[model samples]
Target: MNAIEIINISKTYKSKTKTITALNNISLEIKEGELFGLIGPDGAGKSSLFRILATVLLPDVGSAKILNYDVIKNFKNIRKLIGYMPGRFSLYQDLSVEENLKFFATIFETTIEENYDLISDIYKQIEPFKNRRAGKLSGGMKQKLALSCALIHKPKILLLDEPTTGVDPVSRKEFWEILKKLKSQGITILVSTPYMDEANLCDRIALIQNGKILDVDLPENIVNKFDKDIFSVASDNMFLLLNDLRNYSHTLSCFAFGDSHHLVIERNKADENLLIQYLSRHKNLSVKKIEPTIEDCFMQMLQSEN
Candidate 1:
């Protein structure tokens, strides 16, 4: 069964002098019990789409349904069935961690004790600091507390928007582990993130940018779709090597990737020997064929669109 259905959803924000389209004819269906991800950078309409699903914001030109309930007409029912954690930490900062959790549980007409098992794995980590004010806790601790409150009502669907942004790498890993546990219990999870590596952690992902969806598929499948030869090239003069590679006749595209530059060349038009000879002036020059990553595919898609 599809837990969420969105059809031709478009939202635009208009000011006196300008209008910005947040979502552009977006349509997607998320199956029940699936862990789906929306992958994109900031200002990509991720939060806007999430808000529409959470029933807090309405689309200007389309319809959405959650668990067979129309988002606009059955908002109350949808609100009760889903848990939403916005990109920002929204819990009352002045309240103690325990108080925040209890407050959310009360709003849903349920006690934390009733759904303690659902959140125990996450809550226990922050339990030692239950009396601490929410604003005083560390970033990772704040994340755990927010998640505990979201799950306190035993929601059927979870909408987490960029939950790991600005968090430590270790905490990010731990949080994803908790998500896997939640998925096993049959909760449909929809999470958005700017991290490309995190895409592999999801069952499926939608690559969104500029209020538009670039592609939607499994992580491996998306990587497989990149049908170009890419080579990792490095030289002592990194800056000069980038410009030199881009100017080469066979070069299709080139971008800096950490210590090396990923250079895409026209099929059968260029080889390592030819590149080596061309850049022989630079010291420690090296080139090797490599596989494409999720970010590589995303950049390829963006290049195609342009």
Candidate 2:
């Protein structure tokens, strides 16, 4: 069964000076128990779409359904069946971790004891500090506590918006592990993140930008769509190398990635030898072929639109 359905949804925000379209004719289907990702940068409508599905914000046009309940009319029912964790931590900072969990459980007319098994693994990590005030906890601990409360209700669907942003690498890894465990328990997850590397963690992903979806497919499938041969190039002078590469006639695109620049070349016009000879004018330049990643695909998509 489809856990969520969005049909031609569009949302716009108005200010005294102008209007901004946050979502543009967006439509998608998320299968039951699937870990689906919405990949996009900030101001790219990821949050807007999540809010609409959570029934906390209304779209200016179109509609959406969560677990077959209409977001507009059956909001109360939808709320009862889903656990939403917004991009920002919204828990009570002054309350103790245990108190916060108890409060959310009560709001759902449920108790932590009733859903202990669902969140036990996560909750236990923070249980030692259960009496500590939420504001006093570390970023990672706060994340665990928030997730525990979300699962305390044992909802069928989980909507997490950038749950790992600003978190340490260890915490980010641990968080995804928790998500995988939850998926095993048959909970549908719709997570959004700006990190391209995280896109591979989901069963499928939708790439969004400027309030529009560029593509939706499995991570590998999306990477396979990149038409150009890519290479990693580096030289003693990085900044000049980037500028020179952009001026190269055979260069389809070049962007800095880590210590090297990722150069996508027109397949018909360039090869390793040609790239080497072309950059030989600069001393100590080195180039090597590299596999394209999801980030490469996203950049290609953005380039096409421009």
Candidate 3:
């Protein structure tokens, strides 16, 4: 059976004259043991979906099942079957790392030692300062502790919403490593994040924006599906150069990526030689063809969504 199944799930909030729809008939199925990712930026409904799966909220329309338990009607049972880590650090900060773990375990009427081995690898990293108050810990250590608390009960499914958003680079890598370790223990994980790079870490991903799923596929496969060719253009006047490129009818899409802007052209009509001479009219500039990447695909996806 699918670990999680969401069919035509839709949610909205209302206040006087304003009604904001958070999810728009979103549907997906995640197989057991798959590390599924709901990829999107802030306010794109990633957290809303996670909250619904975690049983903290109800969908206004449609249904969601976790392990065959309806998220709305069987919310209590569903809560006991999964662990959730919200986008923000919602753990009890005044409590020590060890205390927080104990608190969560106590909520489920279980002890940490009962499932010590399940979170042992992760707990070890935070064992040294186990007595330190959670609020005093750095971003990375706090994340580790939260993961430990979530895993203490060995829930069948893990729901993480933007878990690594504010953490440093090293910590982000470490956090993902911890997740992979959890995945190996026969647990299904549903993680959401805005980072395009993290899409490759999941077994499958649903790229979402404006409460809509643009596509669902492996990261590499999604990148390979870019219909238009791409090129990289950089110049001393990069800002002005991008504006000029965007004005051209031949340019399908253009977005700045680090030191270069990935440019999609309609056809060979705007090839390197043509672009070079056209760009030469401006100040110091360079243009070269380049392969498309996940970020490029995401950019194109966002463009199409608009």
Candidate 4:
């Protein structure tokens, strides 16, 4: 059986004056022991979908099943088999690190000693701060504690929502390492993040936006789908250069990427000389053809949709 199965699932929130759709006709199947990523920004329905699978919310249409157990009908069974870590730190701020872990263990009728091997790698990092109140711990320390508690019961599937957001670069790297180790132990992981760079770390990723899925594929395959010559164009006056390039006849698309702007043009329109002559009319610009990254592909997809 698939680790998780979602069929035509959709969710919407209604209020006094307006209605908002959080998820729209989404369907996906995650393989057993696969690391799947939901890549998107805030309000992309990631949280809504996650809450549904976690059995905390219900979808307006369709159904979801975890390990062959229906989310709606067998929520308790599903809950027992999955470890869910919300985006925010939901642990008790007044409690010590050890106390928080013990509390969750008690809820699941499990002891830290019973699952120590499952969380030893992560729990070891925060053991030094066991006496510190959860509120007093650093961002990374809190993240470790949360993950340890989530895995305390040795659930088969792990659902982490934006676990690395607001974390330092080093901490993010360390967190992904921990995930890699867990995957080796035969656990299915479904993680969500807004960072495009993290998409490649997953076995497969689905790019989501406006409650809709733009594309779902392996990261390299997604990059290869970008079928255009991309060029990095920048000049002394960046603002004017952006405007000039946008108005240029051969410029198919242009968007600011980091310190330089990435521009896409038709196959035959990839002429450096022509681009230089066209942009020099406004300002002296430097241009070079560049490889398209996941972010570039995401932008291209969004542009095509518009």
Candidate 5:
């Protein structure tokens, strides 16, 4: 069964001088017990779409349903069935860690003990600082606390918006581990993130940009769909090398990836020797055929769109 359904949903923000579309005819379905990811960079309308699903914001057009409850007409029922952790920390800063969790439980008419098993692994990490004010905890600790509160009611679906953003790498890893456990227990998860590497961790992902979904598929499938031959080129002068590669006659697309540049040329048109001789003037030059990654696919999609 599908846990969430969004059909032709659209949202826009207007000010005196500008009108910005946050979502443009978006439609998607997330299956029950699936860990789905909404992948995109900042200002890509991830938050706006999430807000609509969480029933916190109404869509300007179309409609959404969570667990079969219409977001507009059945918000109260929908709210009771989902756990939402917004991109920002929304818990009470003045409340102590325990207080915040208990407060949320109270609002849902449930006790932490009743759902203790659901949040036990996460709560234990923050229990030591239970008496500490929420504002006094570190970023990672704050994240754990917020998650614990979100799960306090044992909601069937979890909507986590950039939950790992601004968190330390170690904490991010730990948090994803927690998510895996939650998925094993049959909680449907829809997580949004700008981190391309994290896309692989999801069961399926939707890549979004400028309020539009570029593609949706398994990470490996998306990478495999990249049809062009790409080579990773590196030289002593990285900046100059990038400009030269982009200007090369056979170059189709070239983008800097870490210390090297990934260059895509007209398929099967350039040999290693030809590329080497062309770049012979550069010192420490190296070029090797490489497979495309999720980020590479995303860049290629964006380039094609333009």
Candidate 6:
């Protein structure tokens, strides 16, 4: 059975006279035991969709199901079988690390000891400081505590919304490791994040933009779909280099990618010898063709979809 299913789900919020559509006609199916990811930038509606699936908010239209439980009608049952970690840490500030975990377990009518093994790997990081107030913990430590509490009940599905947004790089890697471990336990997982690098970590992902689904597939597959010869160029004069590339008749699209700029050939235009000599004569820069990455493919897809 599909772990989660959503059909043409759309959510809109009204403020004064303006109506903002947070989620469009979004439709997706997540298989049981799969680690599915929702990837997009802020205001792309990743959190809105997560909240709807977690039964925290209702869609303006459409239907959704989590493990065959209706998100709208079976709200109580759905809430019991799902573990939700929002983008922000919402644990009790005055409570200690151990106290917070115990409080969550009690809400689910369970004890921390009963499900200690489920959170042992994560809990161990903060267990030594269990008596410390949760508000006093570092960002990484707080993340661990929130995740530990989420798993205390051993829910059937896990929903994480930008769980690694502000955490350190080391902590982000550690968090993904925890998700992999949880996936091995057969708990279907759905995580959403604005970070492009995190998209590849998932088994599959749906790239969203402006409340719309652009493409849904494995990260490698999406990159493989990119058509056209792409190249990368870097120079000390970044601004001048971009302008020179744009003036070239053969350049299709040129955008900065970190220290280098990525370029696409202008339709059927492929001439390395002539292009190099042209840029040398014009921008006095070094350039070479390079492979496309997920971000490159995303740009292509976005432009095409638009």
> Which lDDT value does model 5 have at 278?
88
lDDT of 4 by residue, 118-204 (tens): 999999999998999999998999999999989999999999999999999999999999999999999999999999999999999
CA lDDT, every model vs. true structure:
0.93, 0.93, 0.88, 0.93, 0.94, 0.89
Clashing pairs in 5: none
**Candidate 2, after superposition: displacement of residue 303 in Å?**
0.3
What TM-score against the true fold does each predicted structure earn? 0.98, 0.98, 0.97, 0.97, 0.98, 0.95
Give the least accurate 10-residue stretch of model 4, judged by summed lDDT.
277-286
Could you report the Cα RMSD, in angstroms, for every candidate shown?
1.0, 0.9, 1.2, 1.2, 0.9, 1.6
The TM-score obtained by model 2 is 0.98
Badly placed stretches (over 4 Å) of model 6 are: 266-268, 281-284
| Residues forming the 10-long window of minimal summed lDDT in candidate 6 | 277-286
Instruction: Quote model 1's TM-score.
Output: 0.98
Report how far residue 286 has shifted in candidate 6, in Å.
Answer: 3.4
Q: Pairs clashing in candidate 3? A: none
Full-model lDDT, candidate 4 = 0.93
Q: Encode model 1's per-residue lDDT on 1-306: one tens digit a residue.
A: 899999999999999999999999999989999999999988999999999999999899999999999999999999999999999978999999999999999999999899999999999999999999999999999999999988999999999999999999999999999999999999999999999999999999999998899999999999998888899999889999999999988888999998999998766677779888988899998899999999888988888888
